[model samples]
Target: MPVLLGGDANVYGMARSFFEAYGVHSVAVCKKALPALAHSRLVKTAVEHPRLEEDAVFTAVLQSLAKAHPDKTCLLVSCADGYTMQLARCREALAPYYRFACPAPEIVQSLGTKEGFAEVCAAHGLRTPQSVALPCGAPLPELPFGWPVIAKPADSPAYWNCRFPGKRKVYLANSAAELEEILAATAQGGYRGAMLLQEYIPGPNTALGVVNAYCARDGSVPWIVQGQVLLQERTPEGVGNYGAILTEPARQDTALLTALADLLRQSGWRGYANFDLKYTSGGEPVLFEMNPRQGRASYFCTAAGANLARPLVEDLVQQAAVTLPVLRPSVWYTAPWGVVRRFCPDKHLLGRAASLRRRGCGTCHLLAPGEGPARRAWYWLRQGAYWRKVFANG
Candidate 1:
């Protein structure tokens, strides 16, 4: 049994990956019930534990679940940064019963914070955006990189918990006044953490790329996956979510893969890690950030015929030699047709998306035979309304 933590589209994608790779149903655990997650045929059970913030409560919940299923081998996987840290903090206590994949608590805390990640990049002499940290209640420093900078939370999960209108994952400030305005708005929005002012890598959206690797404890990576971001959400709240992704075998570069793999190896990282990068005008890819777990866009890797979950399952459960096949060219588009048609600005990308659709490309939502009638009905009803809103707004 694989227990997935987090109930967004990313968790849904993981459930699908595990099911497709191992022919086993995985359980999804979330703080609240997500209708889309409940509709997934791949989820065997949906567990809701609302008080996960409390360590004792979280431990009890996991203890009870593990106690109930004594015979089954369960592997715990956390997709969200908060839960990853939670598990990492308590892994020592839970090691006797429940098995999970994550780095140490310190490692989790270090990589999850933007400031810590920047330090890691500097240690490796890796290329990353020039950035300045704006601490809470401090006077804004002189802009080092100039106008049109990107402002974002130093700690993403903590920042996201704050609620306010016009709050975005990444804020673009084209002028000094706009930068001050956004900073004031964010402070009013209740985000007390430091804000990162970064030099905006100039280019179209196509310059963004996501790369991943599954590292073993001994610093060996059996495989890697990379995806080119074609389309992503443009809304304030939905800013960083990828809506379309593509991967190809020929596109893999040894140097790029090694650089990312070395980051994992040096950090003693074990399990799935996804990196976000943007290319400079001269074609050099600079690291933007790293997600400690499998990213929402990980389904693109699975679509490319390299399911990342397979390696984890094999190494942890099956205890077998994990040989893998080469990744083939594939694409995944999660945006609704209405949203794509209305908001996607690139007509060339639209043409390519259409071509991929015509060729029967892989997708995140796979409503197939044997799916429960209620689940299927819920999927259609929810997705229809979602598309309707997207179309209306677009």
Candidate 2:
């Protein structure tokens, strides 16, 4: 049995993966009722959880859950950064009875922070945009990067704790004054963490690339899938989310894959990890950041025939190394039709729709037949609000 955290699309995909492979339902614990898992029949439990930041409470709850299922081995799966951090920090204490996977605490600490990750990339000779970290309420210094810089949080989980109306994860500042204004406003919104000012890469959403992999406990990656993002859900809430991903047979960047794999091995990162990158004018991919677990759009890898949850369960629960075939080339859809059409102008968009019915091509959050009427109604209600928001933005 797999115990998943978070109720977003990532957890929904994870639940489906386990059910498809092992025929066992996964228990999804979340703080709020997210349509992605709440409306899915695959999830056995979608109960609320305690505040994960409270380390003691989180550890106790995990212990309690593990003790409840004495006959089964429960593999803990976390899809959010905050939850991952808590699990990593408490891994030693819970190691006696519970089973969860993640990188060591030192590795998590270094790679989890934006500034720390940038430094790690620099040490490994990986390309990254010129970035500077500023303290809250500090005057913006003259930056060496170009104008129209991008400002984001150094620590996403902490930043998310600070509330701001109409706040996008990343903001563009076209001038020094604008940068300072954004920084001041962020501080005023209760975010006192470091603000990262990054050089904006000039390109459309198509320039984005992602690499998803499953690292074993020994730091070996059994499989990896790389793809190019054709579209992104640009709604305020979906700014950094992948919309439609295309994984062509020959589109894998060998050099990028090798470098990223080395980074994971050297950092001693275990479990599932994904990298977000953007290509520059010269076609060089620069590291944007690394997610400690599978991304929200990680269904792209699963839809391509390489479900990540399988490897985690096999390696951790079965205690065996499993070799998986390379994923097939396919297009993964997770956005509203209107949003996908708005962002992707490719003539072949209509032709690619045929794959939706095939095994290797599918969606992360589409309501299908055989589902209960209550779940179907919930799907439509959520879908209506999502598309309404996207259309309202236009």
Candidate 3:
């Protein structure tokens, strides 16, 4: 059985993937039971611990859980960045119990942040936006670029735990004053990590793209899936979160896929990787950042024929050969049709979502066919509430 870390959509999505590929009920461990995993029948167990974020607490809890399931081969995967870092750090101790693959600690530290990602891209000869890292609470350095730059946390894990008024995942500053104001507020809110100032790649929400790849031991990619983001979360903290994605054969770019694969091989990296990028007017994708773990919407790749759990179980547990196919057309949705229709800012992409919906191509990460009346009702209510939440916040 797989022991998933986190209670959000990533945990539930991976839990569902495990159950779908194998009939095993995966155990989910989170600080609190979020809606996605609360009433799901797929999860065999949900462990809630207050101190899971602490490195010592995380190591102790997972070690104990591994001991409990000694006879069974337990595979541990974390959805949150902090948890993923802990897993990599405690890999020596956890290795005896779990069967999983992750990047080295130094690699996780080097490639985990926006600043590090830019450096990595430079090493690999990949195109990325011009960026500068600003130390929090310090005078702004003279940027080689002009105003209308992008402002965001260079370290996501540190930023995730911080709560402050007017906090957003990313900020588009129109001038030096706006950028400085953002820096002041972020520092005042207790965010001490490096804040990045980048050249803004302007585009509609639909112009964003994502690439999900699973790298095997020999630096071979078992499968890679790329999709165009149709809509994104407008809420402050959820700003960068994708709400809908479109994957079709017509839009596939072979060169882009090869370039990313080369980066993985050159970096000597393994395990799942998720990348976010945006296209310039020249139609070139500018690398934004890389999430080390399978993203929260990892199921997006699963929908395009890359089952997240199957590869791990086959490669690690079954010790059998695995083959794959290229991705195909499909739509991945985090909410219901009603929610997407109402909240999607671009009407052109909204129409495509509608078309995909009619053909039964849309998949909801949180919705499953096995839910009973009450749980099912709760699921709909939870997703439907996004309409109110977005508008209210606006």
Best by lDDT: 3
Question: How should the candidates be ordered by lDDT, best one leading?
Answer: 3, 2, 1
Q: Model 1: residues >4 Å from true position, as ranges?
A: 341-353, 366-370, 377-394
Expressed as tens digits, the lDDT of each residue in 77-174 for candidate 1 is: 88777788888888887787776778898997777667788789889878888899999888988877977999998877678578898878888889
Worst 10 residues of 2 by lDDT: 349-358
Q: Write the per-residue lDDT of candidate 3 for residues 285-359, one digit (tens) a residue.
A: 899988887888888777766678887777678876556755666789885567667767689777876887688
Model 2 error, position 330 (Å): 1.9
Query: Under the 3 Å rule for N, CA and C atoms, how many clashes does model 3 have?
Result: 0
- Tens digits of per-residue lDDT, candidate 2, 215-264, equal 88878876778878878776777777787787765788988888888888
Q: Model 3: runs farther than 4 Å from truth?
A: 342-349
- For all candidates, what are the clash counts? 0, 0, 0
TM-score of each: 0.92, 0.93, 0.93
What residue pairs clash in candidate 3, if any at all?
Answer: none
Model 3, position 199, has a per-residue lDDT of 86
lDDT of 1 at 392: 60
Q: Alpha carbon lDDT of residue 211, candidate 2?
A: 87
Candidate 2 achieves a global lDDT of 0.78
